[model samples]
Target: MEQNILDKANEWLTPTFDQDTQDRIKNMLAHAPKELEESFYKNLEFGTGGMRGIMGVGTNRINKYTLGKNTQGLSDYLKKSFPNETLKVVIAYDCRHNSDTLAKVVADVFSANGIHVYLFSEMRPTPELSFALKHLNCHAGIVLTASHNPPEYNGYKVYWQDGGQLVPPQDGEIIERIESLKYEDIQFQANENLIEYIDAAIDAAFAKSTIENCSFNTPTLAKENLKIVYTSLHGTSIKAIPGVLAQAGYTDVNIVKEQETPNGDFPTVKSPNPEEPEALTMALALADNIEADIVIGTDPDSDRLGVAVRDTHGKMILLNGNQTMVIMTAFLLEQWKRAGKIDGKQFIGSTIVSTPMMLELASAYDVECKVGLTGFKWIAKFIKDFPELKFIGGGEESFGFMVGDAVRDKDAVGACLLVCEIAAQAKASGSTLYQELINLYVDHGFYKEHLISLTKKGMDGLKEIDQMMINLRENPVSEIDGQRVVCIEDYKNSTAKNMFTGEITPISIPKSNVLIYYLEDGSKICARPSGTEPKIKFYFSVNAPLNRAEDFETVSQELDVKIKNIIAAMQLN
Candidate 1:
């Protein structure tokens, strides 16, 4: 055993920690030296977002002690930021194991520190927590969920009064407060008077607000014809999505019973992430059984959404994040224009890794389109920066979408409703959702995107990822897939270099670890490390002109082959 790890593990045995935690530490020390080292060698980092890790009893894990310390830091920062005003925070949790317990611990810390706490009486989706922050006029909010990680993983995400994740100096300032504190500094005792339980009222209001963001009027005939299947993947959406769909006038909606229950284990899927096909297996099976018009699934926390639509051959096919974004963005803009709502002040947003078709759509509609960094927090920042403009909609390529500025994060509840409405309207117009996607490709040029994520686990994986980024920066590629590399955008350095012109332009965003290569043939490949996961992701995007819907197959295959060749040339496989 290393001396430092042994010393850190010894701290947990103090009288300050409970007997159960001390005993767990003792057990690890006696039998599991490797586990002890992994748990105590370093503290779990509270990154720009928040803390996420496997649940266990260690400074490097998501446990009662770690969560308490984080909450205490947040409480301290809140008091410092608004010394003259009364501080109030809202806390919500998902169905992850121990999430409910962690939420109460967070509330207890806040209440103990003289801050009013509005704790949900039941688990709720993460977006609802974001909405509650604004609706309740609170100072900040926290949600206990890991989004789509594996069963053993859990997280705590903090949001500000503006209903978005913390940004800039705030995130850094909060981290400084957290780092300055020790376990003994956390206030674990609860003040019952300052903690209030919230339920039904907030749910009703959030559901109503989500429904109001719908762009199209309810199509009674279409709603009756569109058969939909939905699964919450054993998370919080089971409490609200079906009700929202019903409110939107959809009569035929089926829920995947096997996954409808809010079970922390997520028994039916290997992972709770809707971005993966296996996560939607139960919903897809149910859709096939009922011959449903569309199948929709949300991640454990219900902020991200995945959809499967019947193709031209009447077989169900899942739509990637980019395709969903294009379809939803186009539908919203077209509806806004048809209703004479598209003034010059309306704008849409997309991340750099997302397909560029959004730019073309915004230009064609004569509206502004802004590109941000990877996270929806950046999109939220965009909305905050340009309050003069109306934010119509926006999304990324990771199955996350935000419609309207009502909620300042990626909202799966509202997204599910809007997507269902789109499907219904398409059905009424004598088409399928898949066909509508084809029409989008025909109108806007055909765009195809593929993402490959390579997971490298444990501490060594971190070093390997860093080395990969370093090598890419030091030895930049000049060509790929038989095409000259016309441009290289190093987001870390905030510069874009033109390979031919030798001109360097500034990228108007904060420094992040991202690299994008643009080929002369109009192909783009972006390399970025996941902020919330132990993985590095490569995003490939290629495009071609679609003359007609009949040639969809050929064009798609060509683009797929092109993506394969590009990946091979880059040796990503």
Candidate 2:
């Protein structure tokens, strides 16, 4: 056993920690040195976003002590940032195990620091927390959720006053404050008078805002005629989605009863992530049995949603994040054009790693598509940065979307309503949602994207992922499947180099650890490490002209082959 690890373990046995925590530490020290080393090797990082880890008692785990330290630091920062004013913050949690208890601990720390706390009475969707804080005029907000991580994992995400995740200076500033504090410095005693439990009022307001923003003149008959099957995947969406649908006049919605209730274990699926096809198995089965028009499933926190619509052959086919994003952005653009709102003061937001079709679609509408770094927080920052331009909506190549600016995060509840509207209107016009997608490709270009994520587990895994990125940067690829690489965008260095001419141009975005290769044929490959998870992701996008709707499948297959060839040539397989 390392002396430093033992010393860290000994510090936890003191009276600063509770008896149960102390007992667990002693047991790990005596019987499970390896586990203890993993737990105490380092402090769980308050990364660019926030902290996430497997729940346990350690400096490197998601527990009362780790989260308490975060809250206390945030409390100190909030007071410093807003002096001479009453500071307020709202707190919400998802269905993950121990999330409720962890959230209360966070709230108590805030209240004990003389900050007023508005804690949710029960589990709520993550997006609602974003909305509640902004609606209640609070300075900050926190949500206890890991989004779609496995049963053992939980996380804490901080939101600023604009209802978006903390960005640039704020994230760095908060992390600094957190690192300067000790675990014993956290104030866990609750000030009951400063803490208030809230529900109903915020829920009603969020539902109403969702309906208003996403309804988009969707007729009552059209909504009634659409047959929809939805599953919460045993998470927090159940508390919000169904009611939002009813309020939006989507009464014919059917819930997958087996997965309707919130369960921390998420026993029905291997993982609770909507991005995985297996996560929506029960919902798809129900949709098939009922001959449904659409199937929707949201992750545990309800921040991201997966949609499966009946294809041209009446088969339930799942749409990837890029396809859904293009479909939704196109719909919103058309709506804006019809309403005469595209007066050149409107822009849509997307990430650099998303499909390039968004740029083309935005051009067709004579609006600018502001491309930023990954994450919806950048989109929210865009809205705040340019007050003159109206934000229609935006999404990334994840199972997340935001409709309007009502919620400054990827809002699954609002996105569900918007997607349902698109489906109902398509059905009313004698076209399925999938068919409408084909039409979109015909109008724009047929773009297909594929993502490959490689998970690396513990300490060594982080070093390996970092080395992989370093190798890609040092030894750049010049060709992909015989296609010449034209441009390379290294976001970390904020430089875009033209491979053919060797001319470099500056990238006007925040520095991030992302590298992108642009081929002469318009194929793009991006390598980025996941900020929230222990995974390195490779995103591949290819496009072809869709001159006719009848040739959609053939062109799509060609693009798929191109991506596969690129992957193989790069030895990524």
TM-score of every model? 0.98, 0.98
**Candidate 1, which ten residues in sequence have the lowest lDDT sum?**
42-51
| Tens-digit per-residue lDDT, 303-364, candidate 1 | 99999999989999899999999999999999899989987999999999999899989999
Error of 2 at 208 (Å): 0.7
Backbone clashes for every candidate come to 0, 0
Residues 340-416 of candidate 2: C-alpha lDDT, one tens digit per residue? 88999999999998999999999999999999988899999999999999999989999889998989999999999
lDDT of each: 0.91, 0.92
Per-residue error at 389 for model 2, in Å? Answer: 1.1
Residue 454 error for model 2, in Å? 0.6
List the pairs of residues colliding in candidate 2: none
